[model samples]
Target: SGFLGFVALNSEFPQVNPAGSVLLPLLTGLFGAPVLLISAFSNSSNIPRQERRLAFPSVFAALKGSIAGFFVSIFPGISSGVATVVSSIGERSDRGYIVTMSSANTANAILCFFMLIAAGRTRSGASDALKSLNLVPSFQEIAILSIFSGIVAFLLTIFFGLLIAEKIEKIDGRKLSLSVLVFLTAIVLLLTGLQGLAILLSAIPIGLSTHFLGVRRINCMGCLMVPVMIWYTG
Candidate 1:
């Protein structure tokens, strides 16, 4: 039924000008909005005070993730999710798994640029957007910018993480969730107008059901994947 709904949406897709007109709002509602909704309505307690301690994973775990990420970068069909799952074989600790997954995602982001330069192909959305905008950079430029931005991002993450940790317990989760939902709706309206809002409104219920119905959220990906399958098969 979800797949059928996705098929029905294909007719509406062409009317939207760019596919992103549908995708941006639909995905936000399908994936993002439900999360906020749950947080808004749930009886979740305030976050616990976080300890200012770091738990670094073993070097071997990082190396394994990097290798898995590189493997995913070189392949067209393989996704980072799949790579992370595969790389997590024999993982015994939750912390190690978290570290491995994070490492794989980070490595995949950085290595994808090298893949783009080497193959003149877009392996990720960022690379695809760069290609679309005709803003592809040189190999050296990519290397330098990637490293520099990575360092900045790392620093910012640590800074903000500590800041958030200190104040997280004081935050009202429900209010924050409601605020985010409003902001998300506003952005959708701004970017795609009434039509996108309609799409977003339609998707929120479906997204909510995936959680309440005990179904996997990943199935929501069919909203995009099914359409792609139809396009290619046709």
Candidate 2:
């Protein structure tokens, strides 16, 4: 780990990529392949669509999310997950949680773009890389990028979600879970190398313990959030 950092300290180190990218392959293999496999094997009955209720007011979620997004945007190292917690003060259903958290993440990113333009700050490594290359975008460029981003997000989340919902009834849950678990394991090993892979394997017991002990997984997020709180306070 330090070898790469050391070589890059005084001079640029040779950049190398892992043999295979993790995300697209993982998603397609973990989700797509399993869905197809399960559908091919399982006999399905046509399920009637159930009426889903909106458990919380969309306006309330949006308003609170906007406020939390603005708050987090002002502070470095705070994440959209924190905003999600802040906005979800009341009891919410699964849909409510999804919409609120997704909205918070999108809102936070949009706010970061504004914050960057206003304060000349690089909130992410991608932004820093672009700055390093003198490719800082103008407001017009950001606007166009944002529009395209919104379209892509809409297509992926809504359109793809609809497709998933349609085929979800045909998929075997246990098979799908096992497929995802194996796919994810391979992905971590490939992308992160042996040490990172070892850490992930080591953490499996802790993760299982939490699930068995019925602990809220939010506590795990303290790993990053706790240090950020200390950083800002100090």
Measured by lDDT, the strongest candidate is 1
For candidate 2, write residues 64-166 as lDDT tens digits.
7778877877777565767888887793676666667777877787777767777887544345445555676788888889899899987686666666676
Each candidate: what lDDT?
0.75, 0.56
**What lDDT does candidate 2 reach at residue 174?**
59
Which residue pairs does candidate 2 place in steric collision? none
Badly placed stretches (over 4 Å) of model 2 are 1-57, 112-139, 229-234
Best by TM-score: 1
